[model samples]
Target: MSWTLTEEHLADLARGAALLGTGGGGDPHVGQLLVRQAIREHGPVLVLDPTEVADDALVIPTAQMGAPTVVFEKLPAGTEPVAALRALEYHLDRTADATMPIECGGINSMIPLLVGALTGLPVVDADGMGRAFPELQMETFSVYGVPGSPMAIAGEGGETVVIDTRADNARMEWLARGVTVRLGGVAHIAEYAMSGADVRRTAIPRTLSLALSVGRAIREARQANTDPVARLAEVLADTLYGHLRVLFRGKVVDVERRTEAGFARGRARVAAMGGATGQLELVFQNEHLVALVDGEVRCVVPDLVCVLDAEQAEPITTESLRYGQRVTVVGISTPELMRSPQALATFGPAAFGLPYAFRPVEELVPA
Candidate 1:
């Protein structure tokens, strides 16, 4: 089924993206407003079903590359993605017939929507990571052998840079991070130009709908005076992400954060609230990567460790975490593609320099 994006759906999309963001992809507030602005000016953008896409059609992925904190301060000049897309089109020597989100998370989720509105291109109802990951190379496209090159990145100042790297996808991220930091800590990136056939195979299908459904479920649950957490878990059970488990519910006790090498790397310590004993600690580098509960490693990436407000159920990003905030930690399984051997080698806990063997959250947690 095809759907047209209207203004009313914006909130649900933002909320859902934040949930899938798993504590990274930056705050969605700025992005929500930007997408709303674009929609209002350009009319409703069409969201195409993956099956509707032509195999030979060109597809482009667009996202902001940088620290979420700096993005808040600098804001988008609105034209960054356009410039990046134009540059990528020039380098690729082809116009994109459609656009897709690099990942389904927070601000990044909204970027592709806004681009679709601005460019009059349909936004594919799919994304790279079923959940957000910190680095460019972490996308399933890279794991599936897609190159991140001939890439175009644009800054707030309107300068555009095209990158061509064959060293490795990690090197692509490394070079892009360096450029992004120099571009004032945040820049618009358009890369992984591909055929619709490849995108249809590699993209996490229906994630946009998945985000909206999760968000709408929470909204309806709240209105109906039900348990939003349980409702959300039930909502997720029907999606590509098989389940969402409550990892911990507590008040934040400590947060160690630093903007090192242009990435927010740190941990959040949450102690059980409401007289419950013990604590849960989350390790993050932009997004939550690991969860250790009561001294046991309960969940790790490529699985998602999402942190939401205990009362409201809104996700809290790594940079936004602080002492004393009440939060509920939840975990979701990564997309099946991301759990493959190649995917694990690229984004597993061990890939993050953590000494744990890669294990799916579904396997690590009781069924």
Candidate 2:
């Protein structure tokens, strides 16, 4: 079925996208603003389902690759994706049947939508990862054996890089990241060539619908004067391995940031509230990578850790976590699809150079 996205849907899309980001997608606010602005300047975005594309259709997933922090600081030249896609298309000797998102998180969620609206292509309703992760290779496309390069990266400065390297996904990530860093730490990227059949097999199906449900639940709960968090928890109960835990409710006490290997690595400490009057610390790389309660590891990657404003219930991206802001900590288990042995080996703490063993969030969180 075809759908036209309107201004009324942007908020829901953002909220839903945040929930799906699973604590790793960059802040969705920037992308939402970009989409809103584009809609005002252009018009509503046209969305199409995977089935709408021809079996032989060349589908491309488009997104921004960089430090989320840098994205906010270095605004786009407003033509990166279009420029990159056009260039990549010219090189491929073909045009895209439809454009889709690599993942649904922060800016990535809305980027393809905006690109589609401007370029007059239908934005596919599916995505590679239902939630976001730090590296490009973490996508389902990679897991399903799709190539990452022969890809395109476009800078706001009109610099474009198209590498047709036959490198593995991990190597491709290293190469692409190096190029992005040289381009001033961020660039728009479009990659993952796949037929409609491959897309349907690997991509997360009905993700937009899931996002819409999540967003609608929060909105309806607020209108009914119910706890939005609780509403969200209920909606996601089945997929979550454990009950939602309100880890902490407090004001940000401190923030420390450093860049490592082109990633924004940092820690945020929050002064606790109510009965738990103390502190909680969160360590992050691009997205909230880990959570510690009073110096004890509470949740780690391969599990979802997120921070949200106590009042707004909006997600607080790792890049945006700061001092003096009141926020609540939330932890949910990663979906089974993402917690497989192979998946864990790739994203687990050991993968990040940490000493912790991989454990299910259900075993980690207190019952």
Q: In lDDT terms, which candidate is top?
A: 1
For model 1, the run of ten residues with the poorest summed lDDT: 358-367
Q: Candidate 2 on 216-332: residue-level lDDT in tens?
A: 887888889888888888877764333566777899989998766667777889997666677888877777767788777777876777787888677777777778889888877
- Stretches of candidate 1 off by over 4 Å are none
Candidate 1 per-residue lDDT over residues 54-138, each given as its tens digit: 9999999999888776776788888899899999998878899999999988899899888999999999999889988889999
Model 1 alpha-carbon miss at residue 57, Å: 0.4
- Candidate 1 at residue 266, lDDT? 87
Q: Against the correct fold, how does model 2 do in TM-score?
A: 0.91
